[model samples]
Target: MAKTSSSHYALKFHRTSTWTMFLVYVILLVSLPDSSQEDCHCQNGCTDFPGSPCPGTTCQPDWFGSYCQKRNIARGKSTSQSSELQGYGGPFPSDKAVDGSTDQTLQHGSCTHTGDTTSTGAWWRVDINTTLEIRRMRIYLRRQNTDRNMGLQVNVSDQLCYTLSADNRQQTVLNIDCGEALNGSSVKISVNGPYLTLCEVQIFQCSNGWFGDDCDKQCQCQNTTEVCDKETGNCRGGCAAGKHGPGCQQECNDGWFGSYCNKQCQCLTASEACNKETGHCSSGCAAGKQGPGCRQDCGQHHYGVNCSSTCGQCSGTSDCEKDDGTCTQGCQQGYSPPLCKMCAVHFYGPPCQGCGHCKDDSPCSVLNGTCLTGCKPGYEPPLCITACIPGRYGENCLHTCGHCQINGSCNAQTGRCERNCQPGYMGPLCIQECADYTYGINCSSVCSCLNQSEVCDKITGDCRTGHQSTTTAAAGASAAHQGQGYDDIRLIVVSCLLAISCVYAVITTATIYRIRRSMKILKAEQMQQYSTLQVRGESSVYDVIAERSVYANESIQRHGDQDPNKN
Candidate 1:
């Protein structure tokens, strides 16, 4: 109720303003003084406003009726609501009026008005800001009649968008030919009173076109030009060259594609896929396509009717699908079909995604026991169907599943068929490789051989004996072929040691004999050295011999000294 009261108050205020403005307008109209018939004052009005003056160079000339009466009647209107009941606005100075010298029929009377109602301020102060696109225009008259001579004029633009005058007010239709698409805030309009009032206006896209010679009431406004030919009504834009629709706008008959499309999607067969651009159904599918999306595989399902859904209930002739003759996984024991895709009464998993009661372990063999590729990990059921019950793995709740022996899923990668037989497997797919000290085909059976013994080939579980060349081999023969048989290695080693010993004795004897001869020579050289360096008593032998000769000389000297004394 409060909101409603506020709206009522605002509306009342608006009506009061309108009524006040209307009263002022009427008072001004009544105050307007009549001019003499001789006055031709349009000569000055033309210079101020855009339009040319009347032929006599003044308004109210005898040639025309009284201008004020005509102008007032041309723009007047009846507003029945209890608001300001005033006539339309009057002419303004500095306005642009249409060129009316040439055609008198195109002119408006002397008193012209120009204004727009705006919410920002005084409505009469706002400028007409719509820039029209289409070229032709018509003026609409309310009640003011005499101000009809003035036409429209635009000050800023060189190209013409529309024409307007009081005469056009009488004409029903108008054409606005826009030379270009414009983007701006406003377009100013100056009609002859050059008088003007605004209804609503529109702007069109570039490349506007018209058709149909008699289209006075109708103009087709559709983008119809991309079509091929006019006869086909298929030029991409516009009504096919020469034709037109009701309001200069209607779609073509056929052979076209667009918002004005007259075409259809096409392909080879009626069911075949079609191109969006062209309307014709042409080439068929590529190699594999049968149903729709080139989707099929006779090599996979091995069935009929475009290999539709997996070949169920197959006939006998095509037993199982084979690529280059490799026997594929076939059907179950109870059921035998062409593709091996289905199962009989109590069989499933590997055969059909079916259900059954697996009574015994041996009966599992009747269906091959494992799921289609076996359940994922901890998951395991009757046929490895359900999970292995959290703690258990393998076919039944038989083994545990954890980091598994192999790097993959232990229960899944290897079947827990072996009962604590070896380290690698406990159930079935003994996937783990041989660990240290262990070697066997399935790592099932242990070998009693030494570490890295080359004692046996684990894969075959047969002793791995190496070979040797008899001619140069230290062992004298290959372990496999020799009488040693891994036992004769010691014998060959002893023989080789004995042979080395005999050769060593012969070499030792020759070395001893040579050493003896060299020793004898060394003994003689040592004796000479001893004689040269050894002393007898205090002197060496050489020294002692020289002393003896010296002693003899001394004795002779004694004799000579005695003789000299005698002399």
Candidate 2:
């Protein structure tokens, strides 16, 4: 029975040991990362805080992570389905190597340093999830193993691309070019060392339509090739036609113009349309157009593109000057040179002032209005601009007529008496005087009897000397010589009338003193005649007495003339 109990205990112990081994294996399987999950390095602290050391040197600011990989899948939870990495023990599992965490970097209690046991020919491989044009690969060493050199060899899609045999010295990172952009989806790294340690493994593929390291640069191939240098971003086959410059952004040369330099030039013919930028006509403006821009028409009185100027009022056969409008030949009859416009009738000069009245009806000089002849009437000249003063007349007002009846005014033009001349003077100009023996009304009357002198009154023509008794008869005969019977009769009748008037005046003056004496004598005589002449009447007697008295006076005057006055 002790033997049976020992066997039962051993069987129980064996079952428990099997279950423990299964459980332990299950735990390890749960902890180990699946190779089909986890794609691209996140670059962790380096990506989050630029310029911070990534712990491993493989990733730089120009790249993404310790392995300098590219992110090819959609980020977050979706990234795990896109890729995987095959490796060994780390803070996490081998597939977690590319999660972008370093040996020191931890997240949620998980660390991402991927390492393997020290064994012969340890290797790590990455499935990039999609086909990619792979150019370069970098490996980041475990930060803790500073002195060790793991001579690594890299292959892309089963093609051996690079070997690290020449750089066997200890290094934090390693970079290798895969020759051309090797068409591949998987990258494998193997090292001939005791073990392989990788904090992270990364696979790179350029983003869609990109070809450079970080896929941050764009390709500018103008011809639609859309291909350029992966590093320099230079066009692979040069820019397309009609394009120039390194970026293929410039157009054609100077002589060529237009959108694509497709249009030919017209400036060669006439030098028009010359400017490349503005396409303006530089020279040779059209017929009527002028100005620098060839946009203006000729100005007023100007013609042609040179703006040749012209003006009005030109005369003579010779044409006017286009530049200044000056007359070339002589001026026209009434017009002047430079401008031949006519002047007003009375005005003359270059600018035609008043001509005034000219002497002798003479015309003035056309140029200066100077009176050629003397001034007319009251006017005087150089220019005939002034008039004569009061009582002055004739050309230049130099002469005077002294025979005016009252004030002595004369004609301004002729210097003749405006009215009749003075008593002795006659003629239109009042220059003639009465003759010595003749006078009165144009000197037509003759001198007859005189009282004082041989001369007669100049205005009346009556003799001034006294005449004798013999002269009276002579005067009558002389009167006959004066003209016709009218003169003879006129002289005799005037003498008799004057003698009768003198006698009447003497009788009337004497009557005042002898009125009473004459009345008494008349009364006595009338009484005697009144009775004797009663039959004849008183009126007849008085008439007879008046005749006798006139005869007596005449007889007495005759006696006194012969006696040389009784004094």
Candidate 3:
């Protein structure tokens, strides 16, 4: 039985030893450093700080400190608020306790108030100059105020962050954590108690785009960089050239221009680009422009790049536009657009004006305003659009026509007098007048029967008076009595002459008888005897005398017949 008992005891001891070894192994495995925590590595021994509450191996993202437990960000970025209360100590300023210091306490250096006021609605505030994200906040309560029971409230950015009841002499500190950080710029603390006091108030920075304890500043460093000077809140190594301002959060204004907008621009005129740094004109200042800043239009005679080249002489005082130096108003009289150098053909007047009366659809000389062809109709030439001047007509209005009765113009092309001539004037040119015996058009018609001194119609040849001239009447009578032939007129004239001669001879014989009677009886007898003697000797005296008289009478009759006007 003793041997069996010994065996049992030995078996039990072995089993117990095995159990103890297993327990030791489990403890060893749990106490050793975890190899899987490699990614939690920290530089500069960030996790070796004394009095730190952080774990030694792992760090949360965006958290870096002596113990890998603190976040580098901003806090209290906006205004803070507090309920009115008298501090227990002599004038303990609220700002003194929240000044990032823990040395002050309610009895001596902290913000404290002594009164029987209710704990509810009592508050204090701190102002963060700017908006920010707040990660956490720590409060150091007065050391001597353990007996006071109070409900504490903490708010961040006007939103409730924490609520707690004070423990009986168990804790004098309060720490509020905003799990994901609160978006705010201010911190507020409120408590309902017999006395309100604080030693120090501390706040941690957030993970968002902010830094500094007051959260009044922004992080402008490159997004690739993860570290900054936590105290000064400066971006490490400064910002890139394109950025400026405290955190390098601002970009340069867009004043740089040319090529890449990297080169500084120099311009003279307001809001214009220039070539020189001082804003003067230079080569390549701007395409197709002149003057400083490339702002002005090219001169009337200049064009192309920088207006360096001379343009064709434009007729008018117009110039090219600045953008491309194109003559939009059209080049000068003789020049064309763009360069304004090419010769341009144009009609007279503005663009809408017609070619006037110029013939053959011909163009005019744009430079001189001259017509290329003759005029049309009433219009004269060279420019040809105008009507002929008074008394002028033909191709160039060069031919002058006769003046009309009312001084009217003549035919434009034919040059005929347009209206009838004044009274006495007649014919196409009005050059002829009424003749003494002839009148009217072409002077072809004879004047009507009237006195020679009387006036007659120039056009109709009508006599003014009803009576005829004596000479004309006589001629008519003579014509009626005689035949149309000249020979008949001669015979009538001869008869009248012979009758007059016979009467004249009889008168002469009577005058001779009277003279002989008076001379006497004495001569009468002698005369008779002589006469009888002569007659007997030669054929009688009376017969000789009578023969001679007959011959004289015949000659006189012949002469009278020859004279056509004698009658």
Candidate 4:
């Protein structure tokens, strides 16, 4: 009886301990948080709940997260689906998925549902309007009928983000993390079957140039205006000023600056580069250029470094070129071209005039137009500007001209006569007297004087008094007769002498006649021979002289035949 009682007491105590452990396990299981409920808490402070009143704040537009700090980029965006279900929860549309509601009930009309069809590829989509780096996506589904969500896919711009498996389909809420973030303008949820459903969908991204899960990390972007990728921290719009590399962390190479390091420095020294931010050269501008950028050209009429050089004498009133200070319209008269700083050759004076004829065609003085080497022929003197006067010619007008037909007329340079010389003169200068029994203008007329040895008067061709001695003797004889008395013995003596002189003159005349006649006869015969030779074209100079002599003899015979005593 004592052994049985002890066994019964031990059995009762073990049964009591087992029941207490079962009760503890049941309590712990009941108190744990449900996986289907949202794990979010009011960040700013929510004032109300769907079924209960509370002192908490509602999230602002596009705001989400525990602290309401992150932005839901897909809220209230445009939405569409493959097909709408019209009856069961009537008018279930795609926009219901992004209406900022997380309600999963079909009767409340907040969830999206596609019509039942035989086609596979049932889908729902939302356009966020602009492209963004999506960090993650959160989706809410109906609590019951979760098996219909299996094989569902989340896509950003048609790129697969996540796919639901049979094991995780039972979960009412889904959190999809987009590794490295996805760049897209629209988001889509697709299923293999024709039926699809969603209560709410949220898309998230970091702020400009910020990335990471908490969006606390800053991006190293080259361009300040460009946004970096949310996951990779890379600038998609290229590097900023003076920077390069994929992440925009590298400094620009030498002599390069500005966006993507594409701009080159314009410093005065070619080896030096300009400031990276402002593109300013530390040194002065290059020649013919000015301004802070060293890109603008010098002002008109100014050139060289800093535009310090002035222009030269250019034509008109226009200014010179800005580069080399040259005259583009040509230089002033008598001035050299291009720079125009000096007088041209053969030119002179500030007013500038052409030079006179110089000796050996040499250049004249630039200041006074003076022929430094002396004047050329026909030109007079110190300035060599005047020509030699009439009748005066030769070098420096020193030599006189010849006695030309027109008095004082000759070439100024050579002193050559214009026409023939004066009467009683010969030769080019007309200074030589007539010679060779010739006395006339140009010494062309022959002199006919009785004395063979004496030439005629150079001016008049008059013979000497001795040439007419017979006339003078006759006059003397008449004078003596008048002075003497008429005596018989003198008259008788004069008569006898006169008679004798007459008879002797007649005899002498007859003798001369006979000789002349004989000479005429001989000359006539020679003339006949000359005529015959002329007819035969064989006449000579002697034949012509013989013919003339014959005619002269005939004339002398006719004269001789006349009586000398007769008048």
TM-score of each: 0.20, 0.29, 0.31, 0.36
Encode model 2's per-residue lDDT on 77-115: one tens digit a residue.
111111222343323444545655444333332323333
> How much lDDT does candidate 2 score?
0.56
Evaluate model 3: give its TM-score: 0.31
| C-alpha lDDT score of every prediction, in listed order | 0.39, 0.56, 0.57, 0.74
| Model 3, position 487: C-alpha lDDT score | 75
Per-residue lDDT of candidate 1, residues 1-567 (tens digit):
999999999999999999999999999997886543222234334332212324443443211212211111111221111111124333222221221221212124322234333211111111224443222223322333434324544221344444455565554234443333333323334543323433322222211122111111122324432422211222344433223443324543333222334333322254543432233334543322343322323445443433333544344334344222222454445454544554654454444444323424223433555444334444445465465443365444456643234333444324443233334332344445565334554465444432224444444444445422334333322332465354678878889999998998899779868866775575576556556654556646656556655675576567546843364
Best first by lDDT, ranked: 4, 3, 2, 1
Cα deviation of 477, candidate 1, in Å: 49
Candidate 2's C-alpha runs over 4 A off are: 1-92, 102-119, 146-149, 165-168, 213-216, 223-567
Compose the digit string of candidate 3's lDDT tens values, residues 1-567. Answer: 999999999999999999999999999999987643332324334343333324543446445443443552322223233433554346655665555456645555545443546544556676776676665677777766555526777788688887765453446676666554577767777766645566667776633434454433445554435554433345665544445555654554443422212344333333554432233433344545544435455665665566676644444676655445566666655455665655555444333234556666666665555777777656776677678988777778877666456575678777677667555556676555746655554565455455655656766656767646667745753553354467777889999999999998898779768765654563454456555654444655656555554675576567546944464
Query: For model 4, how does the per-residue alpha-carbon lDDT over 1-567 read when each residue is reduced to its tens digit?
Result: 889999999999999999999999999999887543232234444433222312343455665533343567778889999998889847998989989889988889999999868668899999988887675888999888888888999988978889888889899889889665677899999988888889999887665555556544446565666777666667877766767665565666766676677766656787777766445777766677777556667887787777898777789887777667778898888888787766789888766777887888788898888899888888887567789888787777888876666875677776766677667777766667788666778777655555545677776666673342455434543543454445656888999999998998899879978986787687787777666554433556655667677688678778768985696
**Once model 4 is optimally superposed onto the true structure by TM-score, how far is the C-alpha of residue 328 displaced, in angstroms?**
15
**Candidate achieving the largest TM-score:** 4
lDDT of 3 at 541: 63
Deviation in angstroms for 465 in model 2?
99
Model 4: residue 461 alpha-carbon error in angstroms: 11
